[model samples]
Target chain A: MAPQDDNVDAVEEAMVAEVEKKPIATIVIIIAMQTEALPLVNKFQLIEDHDSVFPKGVPWVRYHGTYKDLFINIIWPGKDAVLGVDSVGTVSASLVTYASIQALQPDLIINAGTAGGFKAKGANIGDVVMVSDVAFHDRRIPIPVFDQYGIGARRTFSTPKLVKELDLKVGKLSTGDSLDMSPQDEAAINANDATVKDMEGAAVAYVADLLSVPAIFIKAVTDIVDGDKPTAEEFLQNLVAVTAALDQAVTKAVDFISGKCLSEL
Target chain B: MAPQDDNVDAVEEAMVAEVEKKPIATIVIIIAMQTEALPLVNKFQLIEDHDSVFPKGVPWVRYHGTYKDLFINIIWPGKDAVLGVDSVGTVSASLVTYASIQALQPDLIINAGTAGGFKAKGANIGDVVMVSDVAFHDRRIPIPVFDQYGIGARRTFSTPKLVKELDLKVGKLSTGDSLDMSPQDEAAINANDATVKDMEGAAVAYVADLLSVPAIFIKAVTDIVDGDKPTAEEFLQNLVAVTAALDQAVTKAVDFISGKCLSEL
Candidate 1:
């Protein structure tokens, strides 16, 4: 595992994508980050960095970058809770934004970032957790099985075969944004039985379900979501420890993505 | 069946939907020609007319109009493929857009329109059939079990529960603007085991799945997809008997929608 290198910047510089064959593989990865997504990988290798593969800042809409064998591009939509390019009509805009970055047409998307852990007996600090099922914990509609939010009598979340194939630890994930983090938040969080919490994972997961693409959402438990009373600063302060887990997780993810792509071949 | 005061202006007056809170239930009717839509049955009505809705020519968009207890919308995505809006995304936009207009949240969305039937021994000119399954046949990658597009395998499709509940004659409908009008197209259409073809049904189904709302798409067969060897206009003209069938099919759909809504309440 190496650190972010000065020469690695050059390695990123040389990466070029040919439109002749947009890498629409059977497998793809979509990594979402609450803070910085770099540290999760124990081995940080520079695969390819391009001038404009994806999107950039507030004014600039796209940034194109790739790492390891993964043709990675980042679009910071800057929206607080869920941020993906807002598209017109009924299309998956995030997936579209992802597809428009033509270096790799990914079949799977991995949403990796940090989350506030539930701090239950089963979950602990710095544990890398996998969201086995993702859903809007707050959504309540009483259908036949009485499913509401992520807690349903029948089934509350979306769990695909990919989750089983990866052999990752499954935890319930909150799909909606934390608009109001009140005292009763834990009571609601406890109901879903999640290992951690974050905003972007579920949004990405929802799109992946529609695309029928395999998605792996990795969240390093940052703050104990239940300990004391959780706040934004408390979550941000623990960013480094979480990033350390991100480094190894990301490395494993890169390997996983490469294997997935090669398997389809 | 009586007309809605026939011999009056053919094109509708406004595009914005009229409210339908708890309206009387009615049968679905398909008047092939727009002029005949409202005139076929005094009970038969036009939900939305494209000419009047997007009078300014809003391409790649559909407008939904709801009448009390009954909901209707008009959709025409530029008559071909190479779209400005992705199908699923735009349908969500239409659902949300028209939902606001309707004021009355609909129990379900019944898409009423005409479609082309895939050539088969049993299927013939003007056969009135209900879509058993709707899929984007054009969007597929070869897999082990079969060729799937997105749902589970490369040959993914969306089937409405209502189709089976009502016991409507099953028909296959394919989405995407690339109408396979050539004789060579038979092999591929048969690959999915579909009997009918259309452009927007799957998109609507996907959105309905996402919102967890029930949706029924009723398409009247207007032409046949032999292959690209034949032009679209050439094939549509071949189906002369479909005229009356189209009207009957549409009428059934509307009635089915009405019954489904009232029964739920």
Candidate 2:
């Protein structure tokens, strides 16, 4: 065989060896709202994972499918975090995340959703962000003790090579319960130097950390929090566009993981 | 009749009129842990509110009873905000609080539970606190928009007279999703000037605010977040004592509200 053909055969052999040695298994994609989850679900053609039972009666649904030879489970915890009808915030997000972790035993977790970006940080609406670290911007434990508690900053694992390939913005993401913000909150966020804000990232990340499960957060910005338009309006108006971006990001993330596994061979 | 006797009769007549006019109807008490809630439930001899149903299968239970002529509902959402347990963080707390509001139609919501206090704020273990304002020390939304969102600082309705009567420490209570804290968290808490920290207060207060229902948070200090003892150890060691303090505070709060009804009359 020619030299180039021999190299190609060797690469193929290595790929098969890597798959046999360490194949990527289950991955759980946790999204707080159905709208935030739909794009990825449709892109992957995932079906509801009815066999994966949660502790019966928890208000959540899980979908699953094989993507790039890896099992992906998509979990929608509840409705939007917005006030009024069907609002699910941190509590539901955490519980559902914990439940999904237990039920699926995923090798990795990707919390894919939409967030409000900080324009000051060069993040614009529709920009996709990969959370490097998550902190509770709203969690105010008293000073001194807060540091001692060791929960001030929760960092997430990143596939550096994969991140480079995907060219995703890697930054801090802040999580809180409210969609509405105040000047004081803005100051806090700025102080933290977070690029994005969402309701469920911290909670979801916290659970994943506790379980020692590798997790990554991929968020598409639907609003510039400081933009002239109201946040609610911006969120609604850009939901479609942002979610589509999120869908693409999630796809890239899955491919990144799959490629990483093969490249390791 | 003598003048003294006539005055006494008039006073009695006014009391009767007050009862007829502004009777204490519904009071909801939202507690995080079952252990924290049991004291109040036992103290008041509360029975399960069979009529108050949540979305069938949500892991929560509500109890009700007539306390000092006011119908009281006690809701136990879940345990700590940690992983690998029956935990309900902000989401469950808010949802349960909202459900309780809808089902019980409470005129007042008292989020009664245990919290870690700031000793620098002169808070001692077993000291009962009445929340004047609730904010998310963990919820850091970025500036300009944060101010517009109106979620940075959520104030609770404080009846000065009632507070004075109950002799409770009225201060800011911070809410977050984690039980752990770190030095950095301490700085944030100090920045917010919060004296107490818990997982559920802000969520409950937020829902109550949205519904225009007056709410108060009554918390007993279980641990000084900065104390020498670990928070979990302190919490477990002081559980009974702190819960008792919470029980007493709740009773006083009930009496305070009931008295205000009578006083207005």
Best by DockQ: 2
TM-score against truth, every candidate: 0.40, 0.55
Docking class of predicted structure 2: incorrect
Candidate 1 chain B: 10-residue stretch with minimal lDDT: B79-88
lDDT of 2 at B166: 77
Q: Taking the tens digit of each residue's C-alpha lDDT, what string does model 1 give over B199-246?
A: 456656554444334455566666655534353464446534554566
Off by over 4 Å in 1: A1-34, A38-69, A79-104, A142-169, A179-187, A261-265, B1-265
Instruction: Please give the fraction of native interface contacts (Cα pairs under 8 Å between A and B) kept by each candidate.
Output: 0.03, 0.10
| Local distance difference test, each candidate | 0.44, 0.72
The residue-by-residue lDDT of candidate 2 on B79-162, one tens digit each, is 323321333457667767766776677777888888989888889989998888887665443333432232346678756777
Q: Which stretches of candidate 2 lie over 4 Å from their true place?
A: A1-21, A80-87, A147-151, A259-265, B1-112, B115-198, B201-244, B247-265
Model 1: fraction of native contacts:
0.03
True contacts kept of 2: 0.10
On a 0 to 1 DockQ scale, where is model 1?
0.03
lDDT of 2 by residue, A89-113 (tens): 5656776776677668777788888
